[model samples]
Target: MELSLDAKDTAFRDEVREFFSTGVPDSWRDRVRAGLRLSPDELTGYQQRLAARGWGAPTWPVEYGGTGWTPTQLCVFWSEAARADAPHQFHQGLELIGPIIFSYGSPEQKDYYLPRIIQAQDWWCQGYSEPGAGSDLASLRARADRDGDDYVLNGQKTWTSYAHVASQVFLLARTSHEARRQQGISLILAPMDTPGFRINPIATMDEKYHTNELFMDNARVPVANRVGDEGRGWEYGKVLLDRERMVAAANVIFLGQIVRGITDAARRRKIRGRALADDPGFAAKLAQFTVELTTLQAMVLRLLDDMTRGADSGPRGSMVKLRWSQLYQAGTALWVEALGPEAAQFAALDGATLPADMPAALQGALYARVTSIYGGSSEIQHNIIARRALGL
Candidate 1:
């Protein structure tokens, strides 16, 4: 069936697709389609191009360089962008911290940061998870002592995605000592150039430096760097999580795009002198996945519909995040399994080359392994679902 978008939405979608088809760099789209990581230059190039079009931060306040699109429109933009292999703007800057800054930051912070974020001038990484306190974020021991016009921060944040490359890091630090652990926290934006700030790179199984261990040894942060009121970061951080969950929820559609590539591979690969697509078992598996993908798409659209009507997303973002990660991981497993030995070979496609030892299908499978870990572990999300949604 055609997209469930109405005539107006369909028209808008066509416009976006056309824009992505022609406006986005052909070489960059080639890299995204082949699962090749874009170089830093290419990534920022795409981000700036999107910003120049006013599509860089679609969900932000229009006054802050956002599109002011409805949730459905936002959903359409993402789905179409992914299908067209458009490089997404950096999430730390575009999705996570931008909203936090807008909602809880000072007007001066907004004026300084929002345009830079949209224009891809500043790269951001999250500093929420600490060495000893990740899932139990409120119990974090990373303390920042107030010192006149500045706060002296001393702590280590682990699994800080892209911290090594980021120009800034948004930190959740304990600024107060109180009986209520949650009430002692505050959000601080630290420039990467701060004295005593460092990042130790950590490579994933995919052999990508997507994460790092962040060390802040008596880093000097100006009071002006603090967002919102002191001792309220736990609350603001939750807002960021809610937004993150919305992103993880949308992963269902992006992951679904892999199915199309898999099918094309199956068509070209022969099994016993016939196409793998002709195999009954493979066909059945494909059919099952189609059903699952359909359900996921429908569920996500419903969530977006609610947001379009101005209903709060709330814990439902967690629900979708949990389900999307699980489903996408499972689907990736099938992709690798179906490809078997053929996926073992690496060949350049769409002007992008795969890592010599890593085939496209296996690369995807390996990457999917971390879906349940980031954006809060499945266990953490389960607890959130139980406590907030189920009233446990």
Candidate 2:
């Protein structure tokens, strides 16, 4: 497909670009560029600002406060925001559960949750992964036994991002064991302050408390908190996961930032009396990454167009997600390699900050390792492509 903006698109793109340049706060932009996690208060403030701008849930239905932009316009918004290093709406509330809720939630649920979500009154986190159920989410052992008006929850969830601070968590818990393992599962919207729910922080090498382990001990969640019907949580989870596959291309936004940082570093550093960027081998490597990145971006555009045309991008999306994460990991690894001795400085600092680019490169490299794992692992993605796409 030939992808180029005509006059109308050009105008829309300019509008989006100007909004990002002036709409996002300078402090927010700098924190994102530096790879720093925003505090809960900062996150709420920024999300509220985006909500006020009517861009909070750009892809949701218009009745739910969506912007109703065309696919190309959505692309322009994301591209402009990425280029500006602007913070985005919380994906959990805006992308993941928000879609599921609006699609399957009760009318009351929609009226209550969607507004709070839009206004940043509630922060949502995914609770799909348990102690043993990261990639194999179907194997989650969290239980919610029925007790009249409530279900008593008991189990642990690991690697739940932002659980410590999020206002709520959307989890999948087993309500029965008689049928299939994936069956009898139900989605629960558990409040963070619910009795018997606790969070234990898990700090990573990135010097960030990026995830947490959640423990639930006889937590009483109302039957009303259950999303859709019980024993159908797996189906709902699939909807969310498919949505995740769609946005997997979003890795490009960060990949672009890393590539720019690498380019800046190379342009400034000298290699044997010449700019590092002038080296023939270094230039060739960058060219290879550029070509691959471009191809990946083209695939993303195709996926978006297919969605707009009401096509099932399914297995094709698995391929895109797999490649996007792998290419990102490759790009970040190459960036660290190019940093060489400069990387060694951050080696001991838990992630160096001086020279600016060094820490960015190192942190990107470390975080890239997880890119292939979350949303879905490279292996699981391969499995989907193999069985569903190729009929192997």
What Cα-based lDDT does every candidate model obtain? 0.78, 0.79
Q: What's each prediction's TM-score?
A: 0.92, 0.93
**Which one is best on TM-score?**
2
For model 2, residues 1-392, the per-residue Cα lDDT tens digits are: 22488899889888877877775655554345434455778878877877888877777779988888877777777777778777555678888899899889999999989988988999999888987887788888999999999999999999999887789999999999846788999998989999999899998877667899999999999999999998898888677655764476555544555566667677878888998888999999988988888888888888788877887886878888788788877877777767767776764456535765645567767776787888778999898889997899
After superposition, candidate 1 runs with Cα above 4 Å error: 23-37, 345-358
lDDT of 1 by residue, 9-128 (tens): 999999998887876655553235334357677788878888888888877879888999877788888888888766555678888899999888899999999999999899999998
Clashing pairs in 2: none
Q: Candidate 2: minimum summed lDDT over ten consecutive residues — where?
A: 27-36
Candidate 1: residue 15 Cα off by (Å): 1.3
lDDT of 2 at 385: 85
Worst lDDT run of 10 residues, candidate 1, spans 27-36
